[model samples]
Target: MGSATSSRSRASWLALLSAFTAGVGLGFLAHEYREVIVANPGIIGLTLLVVFAAGYLIRLAVRALRRAGSRVDTILAEELEKKPSPRPR
Candidate 1:
């Protein structure tokens, strides 16, 4: 249990680190290629929009899956309750 919790936190920490690295890399690119980025503002906007949309879609899919899993768990529990216990021979 402790390891599971620690791993979950570690995953979140890694995500944060990755996001930070990406932000720094993008900032560096924007600084270095300011002319190119400024010239194609539409491309950058579209890329950001796509990234946000994909993240939202993934979040929705995960939520739906979790709901379905819980429903299956409940259904299985109810079915189990309806069954009789076996007698010892």
Candidate 2:
């Protein structure tokens, strides 16, 4: 379980790094193509819609993970409470 958690953590960091790199690349692309992008109002609107939708989905996923983590912690605490403690010598 510890290893699994570590792996997940590593994956998350990698994902975050990848996202940052992608954002930087996209920024450069936009900078280079500013005129083209500006010329297409429809493209701007579509990109905005997609960005908002992705943001909304990411928000929902984060909320769900937090709720799940809290529920797991509560269950683990309850289970621990139910277990008898070792007797003192």
Q: Write the per-residue lDDT of candidate 2 for residues 1-89, one digit (tens) a residue.
A: 99989998998999999999989999999999999998998989998899989989998999999899999999999999998889865
Q: Pull out the clashing pairs in model 1.
A: none
* Count of clashes, each model: 0, 0
**Model 2 stretches astray by more than 4 angstroms:** 1-25
lDDT of 2 at 77: 99
How would you encode candidate 1's per-residue C-alpha lDDT over 1-89 as one tens digit per residue? 89979998998999899999999998998899999998999999999999999989998998999799999999999999998878765
Worst 10 residues of 1 by lDDT: 80-89
